[model samples]
Target: MSISTATVKERSLLGLKELSRDEIASILDRAAHWDRQQEKMSPILNKHFVANMFFENSTRTRFSFEMAEKRLGAQVLNFAAAASSVEKGESIYDTVRTLESMGIDAGVIRLKPIGLLAELAKKVSVPLINAGDGNNEHPTQALLDLYTMKQHFGELKGLRVSIIGDILHSRVARSNLWALQKFGVDVKFCAPANMQAPELAKYAPYVSMEEALQADVVMMLRVQLERHGEGVLKSADTYRVQYGLTEERAAKLNAGTIIMHPAPINRNVEIDDAIVESPQSKIFTQMQNGVPIRMAVIERAMK
Candidate 1:
């Protein structure tokens, strides 16, 4: 079942930076083909069992990975942290090894702590796909996002993308930044004062929301209130005026500019309700693209 490309076929995709520009392009291209094949079933992982280990809650990522597994004609096992022996304080090593012992071919994991993926990967024989690890990375989400952009404009080179919101706390922001950087994209970071990612000083430090709106894509990130408490974020009205992708901001977008957000968008906060549903918004399309991109990843990971 091994593909000719061992680097992609055998290894797990923990971060977008692990792939070269060519590899990224290849995944995007493969995603396009997979998107076309959506109505059909692929026995790529027929009878193979894949476990979903979600230490943190998620709507799109968890279900999409499960759907991708089912779509590929594989059996899926859901690992519920609350229901399992994890309540007995069983270690992650024991939990993963216990699942691996049950004959899982691959495992998709999402956790709140960074470095868990690498540590767990070492403890089990199964291939590990990082759904999201703390504020560190979400490679598959980034892949689908890149595919969405590619679908719209046909290429990524020279494209300018502004990522606005909880920059320091968004795994989505980090993953997209890394992947987009490889494609020669003009990536900019924007966030409320303390929320900005200081690590991205090399990428224009921080741009005003108005300035960021001029880019090819104005990507919005959720305020991640869970990480940075409600007390830390501004009042809703003030935040809307300053950072929200409002109607005024959307109207000012240069032609060919698209609005994007990684979902569970904070209504009237990081983005306005109108712009989220507007013609210029690709927020929904990004979610739609997630399936095919994940299908490609799961299919490849089982190889």
Candidate 2:
């Protein structure tokens, strides 16, 4: 299960917490390059075979990676846990090893287990990319978010960003906190007491929702309603009044400030339905930006 340090470092996209600023910048720059391409398809990865393995359910992340891989001309294999042998109790490692034995050039994996991706990277010879791993980090999501911000603002330094809602279970927030700090961006969090991630307080301040809306970016996280039992959230209406980006609150934002949400949005829970597509909102832009950013990431792994 042991691997060389060079192998692990060179191939895996485990998380952004360990990546240096320059390393992150390079990925963004590469993503920008990919974004500029007018051609719909490139054969850079022509002969390479890559696998998209997901042990957890996903919609955007799964399809985004698939689109990126195909756009680069890499042969692709898709695996879903619900439809696979995993239902019969096959271990993740055994499944990955089975794929490795089939000659996949690289693997894109999403599993629910925290910290297992790092451990899996060490044991697997082929490079592994983290799709979204159990609230630990969603590096590609952060990468695209960084790319989108850089595209609009021209620089990340000194930019103010407040990530509001569901911080406790958001891998997006964790990944963005680590990556944005590398560029000297001021990142803050805003959430209800029960929804906060206290461990991250040392890294970023938890601000009042009123104060959070004053920032350069108001990034709303999806309210994880499934995690909150009946008593946990009195009702969606209660959460909206206290923390959701209602139209009144959105109207109060500075004209220059932008709105954001990593989607599967709750429509009226975390943000108003009317604001989801407003001029200031980058909700769809984030999804579009994901493809090129992911292209940059998959290219890095395959090449």
Candidate 3:
């Protein structure tokens, strides 16, 4: 069935609270089906406009969102922090107001500092989509990740998923926790003592890397070097030993357990190159699914 045909509740997705479990499942299913049909069908037929405001550097997410919008026949306007009035100390609210005045249908924003997107969502008139908001959340990325896991494991219910490395500074980890919990997946967080997700017990249990590796899906997130000041990690070897997914560690995972990473991998650091390229790795699929899943989100939001 077409995404437009799905009965998504009438709500703005400022957070996951607006979506029911069934709505999330329907979106993912429609995304998968749309991915296959894009070769033959044009999903976005009418003219549309979408604005992408990125206050931080990005590669996969920014490009993937742009591609998704274009694939659905929407005109995309890119706003970079460096080129914007933020150089002159313009407030984020003012910038968002300026963009809203431009009459865009929706905005995809990535910002540093937690809760920035939520704050912006409060002011913007159009639908506000969080691309990545500091260490807070990247809802779409999490959605795509869940979609990838569902594809690999055949279902999300009761699947044990472990998210390892730099959890404190990762928006992906935060979003994944919410998404996994929403779908009834058993979730685990693995990171250094100082870098574990803040207030971990409030959401899900925190575990050591060893325990997390035992799960059916192992996700490794890149360390945000920008957030961690210079010389904080000391040495790559030290980080790798404590938190990296080495080949030996990969060998310990249960058979059919999927290895994943949200990309721009720090090879030999968070993941051994061999495991990243292995047969069980779904990292590439996660990246590939971004386009279709994002298309599904944009379509649903606009309607």
Best by lDDT: 2
Candidate 1 lDDT over 1-303, as tens digits, reads 532344433557778867788877878888888899847677778878999987777867898888888888989999867777877998667887888897888888888778877777665666789888998999998999999998999889999999998888888998898899998899998888888778777855588877888899999988766665557765767777888888887888897899898898889888888888888899999988998898888877785
Model 1: weakest 10-residue lDDT segment is 1-10
After the best TM-score superposition of candidate 3, give how far the Cα of residue 183 lies from its true spot, in angstroms: 1.6
lDDT of residue 135 for candidate 1: 87
Give me the overall lDDT of model 3: 0.80
Candidates in descending lDDT order: 2, 1, 3
Which residue ranges in model 2 land beyond 4 Å of their true spot? 1-5
Cα lDDT over the full model 2: 0.93
Between candidates 2 and 3, the lDDT winner: 2
Task: List, residue by residue over 117-227, the lDDT tens digit for candidate 3.
Answer: 766665556777778877777778888899998887788899998898888787788778877888898988888877875686578788877788899989999976656
TM of each candidate vs. truth: 0.94, 0.97, 0.91
- Candidate models: Cα lDDT each: 0.83, 0.93, 0.80
lDDT by residue for model 2 (1-303), tens? 544658656767999999889889999999999999999899899999999999999978999999999999999999999999999999999999999999998899999999899998888888899999999999999999999899999999999999999899999999999999999999999999988999999999999999999999999999878889867788899999999999999999999899988888999999999999999999899999999999999999878
Model 1 TM-score relative to the real fold: 0.94
